[model samples]
Target: MLFYLTTLNLARFLKEDPPFIGEDEIDVQTQQAIDAWKHAEFLCRNYLLNGLSDTLYGVYSVKKTAKELWNSLDHKYKAEDAGAKKFLVGQFLNFKMVDSKNVISQVQELQLIIHGIHAEGMVLSESFQVGAIIEKLPPAWKDFKNYLKHKRKEMSVEDLILRLRVEEDNQGNEKRTLNPNAAKANLMEHDRGSKGKNPKHKQGPKLGPKGGIAKKPKFQGKCFNCGKMGHKSSE
Candidate 1:
């Protein structure tokens, strides 16, 4: 389950509207971390489902080792790793979920991981360090360990209520905009007018003498408004 969730999140990150970073440009260390997480998740899941008790411990150990490897990566390496760093950040949530026995604990841990990832992404000038990231977490999160110990199990309820609330809230805040097709058409029309291609559009008409088109003056004329000899003005 954790493996699937990580895979899905990684896919979404890669497929973002403008893309966070390029996949092909990712560095070796980042790619190694991504592969390690994927392999660890697979081994952990297989060991658990197959009821291989001894192997399960080994799998968990490997998972921890892989996570440590990821956490130790330097900022220069991470930058070169591109999308791999983002992928590894997401894998932290997967790591928390893999061993958690309670839903609340899982959610809280996942939330912390998300917050850390967000902070790391936002702080562009600094190096990403696991210790530094943990240090930056809010006091509320630090106190959550004690809070989780006393928390009761929630009732088994359908998630439809939450879904409906989210939908309604989204609808309320949504902005209406011109359709892309209409916007493209409007832009094209604007460009045509700006380029003087729209025949009926005119800012000034150079009227011809009588029925013929007026010839452009080769030299400056006296201004009609001020009666200046070197300049011409139109009322």
Candidate 2:
């Protein structure tokens, strides 16, 4: 899909009014804009294939609709026509419906396309100084990019701290690696201590004659009936 777009005679399709010449020939910015649109179209195609299972590349159909709609609008209304803009917006929203089932994968791909569109919009808006072209972008696409930028900024301090902590832990672990067997033994010992067992009987303080102050008895007696510890018959 990307190959088809880049290889195709896109300049011919663009139909520049005066026919761009040597210096006016496809500039890098224009090329990037075309590339972004091409990528978006490719993603839209794949999205339709997997989502609708129609096997028809619907992006061309959508573009046809956009072109027809653009032509139908009044020359003065083209830039501000809410109705025409809504048509494009509706198409974008329809494409978004494909995201529900394969959300993670679809979103990942869509995010790339949206980012590309946003970047392209920025270039067009700045390089050509076309506000209307910038406005042509889907509102959701613009919002998504803004949201991503905000989230990135919000995480700056926390991300720095987390990265530093990870680096510190990596250095510390590299300096001293624990033996697996010893680590396993230490874990078992810790577990035993928590289970009311005398893990270090020799090191533990001894019981005294002080009333109720002695270390609790490990066992009272064995039950003859149930064969359980801490129980005795009143014989």
Candidate 3:
């Protein structure tokens, strides 16, 4: 605004208030100046309103001047002093990686906290952030934590997180691949168990009536004509 007003020779209107005796009664000079100021104020209002969310623009839009609107917005978002720094640090300390999402997502959330602290002018070294994240990894990632610690190359936070995301993707693909095979093996075993040995090939008592016949009576044969146990001769 200052730049625009100074370069365009409208600075005086911003510096000194325009005569407000009455819009219709204003002289040509006063009218031109007021018109210029109103135009500039309109542009400024548009700028602020454009940046604000639909819900908040109405609150700051009521300000009478460009400077007041800008200052109000600045104060609303960027709190001055070291107090915000302490708050950001507290957030960083309280952040913990949970197993709710992939390791990459958890790490990204922690990175966001580190970035929030940085945005407050509290600089944290890359290595420090990496170590903090490693320490916060969920219990399931113990082996991965050790693997990262043993790496000879110190990786950037972005690079490490990328690797984590890739590892998670690979793990997911492998699980999908193995699950079908495991299910198939289990199904085959169940089918084999459900089917008994073939009846024709099986070794067991032969099929019979509900109860076997009684033992045959002892055999006795005689010839009636000869009355001989061994033979019968015809007379």
Best by TM-score: 3
User: What lDDT tens digits, residue by residue, belong to model 1 across residues 54-97?
Assistant: 65455444423323323333333577667655775666634532
Query: Candidate 3: which stretches are off by over 4 Å?
Result: 1-35, 46-58, 79-92, 98-105, 112-123, 140-153, 158-185, 189-235
Model 2 earns a TM-score of 0.18
- Per-residue C-alpha lDDT of model 2 across residues 97-145, encoded as one tens digit per residue: 2312432344344444444545434222232211222233344346533
Between candidates 1 and 2, name the one with more favorable TM-score. Answer: 2
Off by over 4 Å in 2: 1-3, 15-235
Candidate 1 lDDT for residue 116: 63
Model 1, runs deviating above 4 Å: 1-165, 168-173, 177-203, 206-212, 215-235
| Model 1 per-residue lDDT at 127 | 27
Clashes of 1: 3
lDDT, candidate 3, 1-235, per-residue tens: 5475467554443334424667577888887877877887666556656767888987877877666666776676666546778777888888777766677767777777788888877898988987898888888778888999998898888788877888788878888887878888898778777885543575655544656654535425576775657554343
Which candidate wins on lDDT? 3
Residue-level error in angstroms, candidate 1, position 200: 8.9
* Candidate 2, RMSD to the unseen true structure: 20.9
Task: In angstroms, give how far residue 234 of model 1 lies from its true place.
Answer: 23
Of candidate 1, the 10-residue stretch with the lowest lDDT total is: 10-19
